[model samples]
Target: MVGFLGTYQVSLDEKGRLNVPAKFKGLMDKQYDNPNLVVAVMPDKEGRKDREYLIAFPQEEWLVNEEKLSHLSGLDGDDRNKMREIYAQASECEVKSGKILIAQHQRERAGLKKEVTLVGMSKTFEIWATDRFEI
Candidate 1:
């Protein structure tokens, strides 16, 4: 499957809208043909300081992940909580006029300021604070 690639530096407007790069946008249009996206905060896995970021997935791709999560045994407390957290933190957004608006809570959770970096990651893309994103 064709996937997103490369890094883009973007600025968040006062209203929290991000103008997605044309290359990535084109890929999304051609590959997914969807204007909807799912965004969620990704906490630092290594417990590193100031390393939190946000991940965006096309609606179709997000649904695939949701399907996988559905197979997990809800009888297990941990599995149930994991599903709850993942579903709770994810937000659906629409790409309008080549821009997507990041929710305020999500932006705060990711520590997003004015300047941000969008990094392509195959099926998904990540948004990181420019200062915290290391090469």
Candidate 2:
């Protein structure tokens, strides 16, 4: 599969609900029987606050990654820490009426406001505050 491919401008409702782009939604439905997604705060390699964003992975895709993470040796501290951090902020959301409700903590971590943009990135998609999104 080519995976998700496109940039869609959207808005988050006051309650923190985001309307998934129709194309992305369609792809998810066609690719996975379960309409669930795992949303998490994307860590910035540069640790720049301005570059913060949230990433969403289809449930099946996330499960695949989780399976890999599960095999890591528990004796490795770094690996344990990394898994803890990733799982700590990850949220499982169900697509309902073409929308998903982003948790408040995830929204705040990404500095998401009213305007947001959804960028397709292969097996995942990203959510960025419109003002913070730069080509």
Candidate 3:
């Protein structure tokens, strides 16, 4: 699968299914097959619960991240625990028919009701509520 790298707006239906943009789907075809994606809800560090969002990463990329974290040494125990917590909270999901499911908590935390913006960062994608973003 191609690395995540762009942004697109998508509509979130009542059931929480949202389309991954066509371009992103095209990009997926180039880099992966039977693409299994992972989703994680990350809250802002500054105590803004409403500022949380979901992050999706291609399985391969996630594995790389996992490896990097696994190899961490000489780090404080608290920092390592935090990383473990993040990884444990992530969910493994599949991209089907160009769409993915955002968990209810993830939707609510991000204030995603009817619409969402899917942004592709270098190695992962971020889900932001339409209202949380400025066009």
User: How close to the true structure is residue 50 of candidate 1, measured as C-alpha lDDT?
Assistant: 76
Q: Candidate 1: list runs displaced more than 4 Å.
A: 47-49
Candidates 1 and 3 compared: the better one by TM-score is 1
Which of the two candidates, 2 or 3, achieves a greater lDDT against the reference?
Answer: 2
Superposed model 3: Cα runs more than 4 Å off: 72-77
Residue 104 Cα positional deviation in candidate 3, in Å, after optimal superposition? 1.9
Name the regions of candidate 2 deviating beyond 4 angstroms.
none
Give lDDT tens digits, candidate 2, residues 1-135.
878898999989989999999889999989887888999887778878778899899998998989998987778998887788789999999899999999999988889999999999999999998998888
Clashes by residue pair, model 1: none
Worst 10 residues of 1 by lDDT: 41-50
By lDDT, the best candidate is 2
lDDT of 1: 0.88
Q: For candidate 1, write residues 1-135 as lDDT tens digits.
A: 768899999999999999999988888898886758999877787866478788999998898988999998899998998888677778998999999999998888788999999999999999998988987
Best by TM-score: 2
- What TM-score does candidate 2 reach? 0.92
Q: Ten consecutive residues with minimal summed lDDT in candidate 3?
A: 25-34
Count the clashes in each prediction.
0, 0, 2
- Please provide TM-scores, in order, for all candidate models, with all chains considered together: 0.92, 0.92, 0.82
